[model samples]
Target chain A: MTVNRQIHLVSRPQGEPSAANFKLVEAAVPALTEGQVLVRNHYLSLDPYMRGRMNEGKSYAAPQPLDAVMIGGTVGEVVDSKNDHFKVGDKVVGMGGWQEYQLVDANQRGVLQKVDTTHIPLSAYLGAVGMPGVTGWYGLVKIIDPKPGETVVVSAASGAVGGAVGQLAKARGARAVGLAGGPDKCRQVVEELGFDACIDYKQHPDVKSLSTALKEACPKGIDGYFENVGGIILDAVMLRANAFSRIAMCGMISGYNGEPIPMQYPQLILSNRMKIEGFIVSEHMEVWPEALKELGTLVATGKFKYRETVADGIASAPEAFLGLLKGKNFGKQLVKLI
Target chain B: MTVNRQIHLVSRPQGEPSAANFKLVEAAVPALTEGQVLVRNHYLSLDPYMRGRMNEGKSYAAPQPLDAVMIGGTVGEVVDSKNDHFKVGDKVVGMGGWQEYQLVDANQRGVLQKVDTTHIPLSAYLGAVGMPGVTGWYGLVKIIDPKPGETVVVSAASGAVGGAVGQLAKARGARAVGLAGGPDKCRQVVEELGFDACIDYKQHPDVKSLSTALKEACPKGIDGYFENVGGIILDAVMLRANAFSRIAMCGMISGYNGEPIPMQYPQLILSNRMKIEGFIVSEHMEVWPEALKELGTLVATGKFKYRETVADGIASAPEAFLGLLKGKNFGKQLVKLI
Candidate 1:
């Protein structure tokens, strides 16, 4: 028997979650049954969607239950296995939660996938090459379906999903623009991510000024939009959108903190003849195999790239998540659980 | 030579349009050349969309040109025809402008169509069986596409498009609810138009109260919405939308007077995974024949009913249009100009 260190949600957050809401607990790892494989987690992904799960109200997915292990995506190695499929020393990715060890049934669907980490790092499985990357792929390819030469704008451009969106848009021959929080992140978006232009949202005081900035950045007017951060950014994009534009509503991290974020120009949706659709990637499992293959190839080649804001040890997850909610993390926020 | 009385837009209104903006001028009707037909106007249709055309800025359609005849939909008798397809006394519908006569070419697309008013009244081509009715059909059937047993809510319930939306939703076996200005209009929406319920927006005083009323009315939550009036009504509906709900944004008469209308819960759009699309029916001319056939059949069979608030002559059109924008007209507002 081995001792497993786990993080539990001690209390529900009122506004923004603090470290006090989470508790670190040590418990004995259960023995692997016949169909079970033991995974020793190496990294835990901290995402904006997790903040919504922490809330007590209804969102796209169910709220994360209190006093239970904090839910997350983890890339780990199969330490032990009684299952025929997964052998010891095999690397895999699964919903291993914020813990050092996860005992998952091999027969379950979407629980475990044997990950080949030869070309890319294992931590990439938790970010750009995984769910966040697939999210950008599915939203852009399926919903927006931008044509070549069309201008596409993405919010949170320096973050995992937005970075992927900008790079993918560029790969598809569309002019890509990004909206990031600060000057440094905006610079990274245009220079490192290869976006055509990046707008620093902090430089503009209000939506009107941001809209003016967007007008200057996207001279052709936005034909397609991949919305990650909502509120003023959404309103700004709407003001600058051309007729018959498409917007993919992926995440609204701005409103996740329980603040009322109003959209000022819904009439533009009618005047511009636009279509806005909100989607969750996990609910669409059919796209995963195709998306994962494309994402894996992009990451394997130097064409697709990403950065990680890594926190050492599982105990730092709560503070790291808090930082992400405040837009402190530059890219994919991850906690090194090993 | 026949004398034609025409209503010309003398000046653009700063805010809500008034009578001084229009001028009635008498001129000789142009002789019908080869392939042209001279139409004597019978009825002019006044709609909320015309208000958008009056503005100086860009809308879906071109702005109403200064000092020209006010653009509108008209059902008139073809007084003289140089084209082989038309004959004198034959009723036709076209964008005839606010004039007593119109000389149009037969080969011109969207110019004129020979309308059979044998089963339905000639004016029905302007209301339930016409442009307003087709607007509702395209918005509900094409965009919302609510399934049987789903609930659909329409704002401006007593208006032309809203009434059609409620009737069409009922025909498709869905529960139809409405939002109208006063108790009288609300009663007419439920009793005359066959909606399941009608909420009087005036009684509520604010969006929060209206939202509470919507919660009580739509116990299953709004699965589909036909947005005709924006502002508080849209805000109320968003708070009560179920997961994966569809909204067809047809009009926003509430904002036509230039008030800034903000949507309070755009986050619900993400949380509920909803889709909202804004479209113009004229741009989609392919769906007209099918939509008109269905609308005509329903109106002829009395399954679809409509009311008209008629203004006496071309002289009363400007006042009637101003009143229609203010939600003072109970149904399809028209000007009788025989």
Candidate 2:
């Protein structure tokens, strides 16, 4: 039996998660039952939603159970299988979590899928053509519904989801604007990703100053917004939104630290006739096939650009997740676990 | 020629408007030209939107021009007409301002219209069967779109718009709940209007307490909300909202006083996946004909109920309007100006 190195949640986090809250453990791989496949995970996806799972409360999904393997998306090769549908040495993408190996039942729908990484890189399954990419597409096409020539804004502009949102907005013939944490990310967002303009939010500490910057960037006014980082960024956007605007509330990364951050100018939602909606991509599984097909085509054709911040091993996942919550990671954060 | 007594806006209000800001003047009626009709105003509508117009800044429409007759809706009798569409003794509704007489041109399509009040009460055209009623119907039908067995909440429940909203919500097979200022209004909202429950906001004094009451009233959670009075009441509704809730923001009477009131817990808009939208009734003229037909039928058949708080003369408009901002006037506040 092979040894499986795994990361587990030792305790629920009170505020920002600490190194003490996670543990790295090694265990023998259990024999797979009928209709099951054993996956040897090569890469584990780390995202901001993990912070909410670490807490003992209900958010979009249930809180992570203590002492359980930390939940995540993974791309790997199937080392062994007991089911007739699968064989050894097959590559797959599944919710194998933050572990060296995972036992996935073939009958369980949406838990496992075959992947062809000949034209596309394996890591792209967890970033550009995966969950984050689908999230951006869902918000942009279904909720934001940007019209031609309308200005669309995305927060956390250089990150995986925001990058996809900007590119998708531009693809629809809309003016795409971005808001990023620092100058470097802003430059990458505007120059590399083809966004019309990018506002470096770090230069403006308060919402008032940021609003001024936003006004100068979006002279015609924001018609659609993909909100990733909430707090002052959302407040600033509220001040500049045009009549009948739509906002897709994707994530509130700033308030994931258990702080009660209040939203200001909600009355603006009324004043501007804005429509804001929160959604979970997992619950909307019906659109994944269509989204992934489009995303895969875009990435393969070099029309879509993406970047990754890869940690060395499985043990680095806790630290990488901590860095992600603090906005330390420049792009999609991942653990190259083997 | 008959003399016209008019109340003109002497100055734009800095905050809540006062009697000093209006000047009453008696002037000779202008002679009718081609397509012009002479209207002797009978009832002048005193609405909350007038307060927004009294300010120098914009809301939905342009600010009421300073030193001009206060913009209002009126039901009147056409004393004389040069137009073929209207004749003497015909009862009509028009945008006649705060004046005892108005010269209306028939060519202005939306400005004037003849009404058949033989079965329906004439004054109902300005309240339950007019702009306020249409406002309620549009918000509920177009935005809220409540499903059967869902709970619907309305703020300012005893007023014209809120009353229509609750009645219409119940008509759609949903349980209607209300929030009003005092015990009397709350009683009327529940007892007279057939709401499932009514909470007196004056007793709660804060959002936390009111939210507790809302939880008890709406065991299924609020599926739809008709926002009329914004402030603590809006905050309370936000806390009790369920996933995928919808809010139709018709008015924010509390903010009309010019004090910058911040909305609390706007994150609920994201957490609950709620959709909130602000709208102007006049902008959506396509729905008017269908809405009027339904409202007229409901009122004529006694299936729909309404109450009126009538002030004696056109001069009482300012005081009645002041009372409205303070939540003193119940139902639709109108002036009997004949």
Candidate 3:
């Protein structure tokens, strides 16, 4: 129990990540300091953003250093606390990385916060009501700002952030359309997530084909678009976008592996007079409280639905993360440690 | 004179327009009726926007109808009037098209407007205090909206709209950078237009080379961009754009001839978190009054400088317009009708 198992990034991947890029190591957990708290991580979040951190390229965030525990979001229980804020057995959320345990400086701001899991599940604190949820909220509410009866489209509709975007749009009385990978995920997006329509993107691989499906799903044309996957999905959406459409650029997971995905018709941006903006959610901390409160209430009351794909242990994190990048995960990919 | 010599669009061009596309025709002047005002146009504005109308393709404005006098902005003196608002010899600005004379229904809104020409010259009404100036005002003040000390970049800096963009950015306390075609134009952009720095894009044909020049010119990176010429210029500007930069998509003349000028690195929009919005100045009529007032004052006081390349007569309009599209025009291209 004193030994902590962690996965460290050994080498950066050229294109797609592989097993050899990561290494497993065991180290003894050090005793807690005067202001430090010891936490045993129960679940680790695996996101497509992790793929970006693995590269040495300049991005919104710094690259994850080699031979360091992979950077991630985690939910855990505080076993020992030196600070009054976090008590023992309190479930908290923090950037605990891909490790079995975490030693957090309790005095540090934004390091750790106790979450109420009385209604919402503990693992869900790392999913909804967390970073991903807030990301979706900011992109939709701030950038998109879709009007009632406007049609809003989101790529990767089965994922955590995309699901939240569709639900938020629906709540605002806008038509929420989705684009997902396979037939199964597409079905879940419309049936479970309650999106008005979901198109199976795999069935329509090219821009023209996908655009045809999008037009059918959204008869009035796309008024707002939440972009998670770039390339053909973005190209297709641009074709169907209405005049004065708003496109909130979130993640470009489709181009994360380093292929150049150019906009085939950027001139449409000028012709249609659209507004496209990209944003990083962490840069906007002001919206977190409001976004989390609404997300937590909806999730707790079952008004908002979400799914999880949990891999058993920390050793399975790298594979789970790779699966997430490949769209193998049906929903929020999480690594269960406890 | 009872005859009106007018240039008409006889045929739409396949790619670049030539003399064969236009025809000179003569028509008898009609007798004045109720609410009618007849004007002898002195100057016809030969703007790049007219080139867009020559194509049958969809654009911000309607296509130039074949066998009709070409649509344009003109400043002239009223020869006769039946309306109480306008009198003979009154200097005015209106959409008089490419003709020696115009019969305007003064009762209709936005048709005929009386001008003082006390401080501002009659010809200046078509260039600095007209649509081109308002176009620049909308992009710089309304769209780009640069804060003090931020850097702004405008391409085709010697052109009327581009010249105004750089000047407005300077007025707002922003560092104005420019990208012009040749050395002569580049020199005028910095020396006459007062841009902080100007890069001659002709020296650097490729994105990498142009981006290198842009880096030297804009040390802090581009904070706001006014796009006039798209394709490589836009691609080069995208490379140097700072995070959260605002790009006003005013024109894409480089691709106006019907070619796929794809944005080579669309992912950069996401990585840099930029806002790219397209707008047509005509669509926003609300800003015209305030824009024209400031523009009229600036030009009248000689604080604002402009150059015009005037063709001998309306018969030379077709060749002069073709030259403007090929970057041969020194500044604002105009046709002398009287």
- Candidate 1 lDDT over residue span A1-338, tens digit each: 69888899989888877899999999899887899999999999998898888888766788899988999999999999999999999999999999999999989977999999999899999888899999999889998888999999999999999998988899899999999989999989988889999998999878899999999999999999999888888998999999999999999988887898898889999999999999998888899899888889988986787889999998888888899988899889999987
Which of the two, 2 or 3, has more DockQ? Answer: 3
List residue ranges in candidate 2 displaced over 4 A: none
lDDT string for model 3 (B16-48, tens) is: 789999999999899999999999999999888
Q: Model 1 misses residue B18 by how many Å? A: 1.6
Q: Where is model 1 more than 4 Å wrong at Cα?
A: none
lDDT measured at residue B2 in model 1 versus the true structure, 0 to 100: 83
Worst 10 residues of 2 chain B by lDDT: B258-267
CAPRI grade of model 3:
high
Task: Return whichever of 1 and 2 wins on lDDT.
Answer: 1
For model 1, how does the per-residue alpha-carbon lDDT over B1-338 read when each residue is reduced to its tens digit? 68888898888888888889889988898877899999989999998888888888877788899889989999999888999988998999998999889999988766888888779999999989888889999999999998999999999989999999999999999999999999999989988999999998989988889999999889999999999988988988998999999999989888887889988888887889999999998888889889999999988887888899999988888889888888899899999997
lDDT string, candidate 3, A38-122, tens digits: 9999999998888999999788789999999999999999999898888899999999999999999989999998988899998
**Residue-wise C-alpha lDDT for candidate 2, range A166-265, written one tens digit per residue:** 9999999999999988888889898899999999899999989999999999999999999998889999998999998999988988888766667777
Give a tens-digit lDDT track for model 2, residues B69-147.
8999999999989999999999999889999999988888878889998888889999999999999999999999998
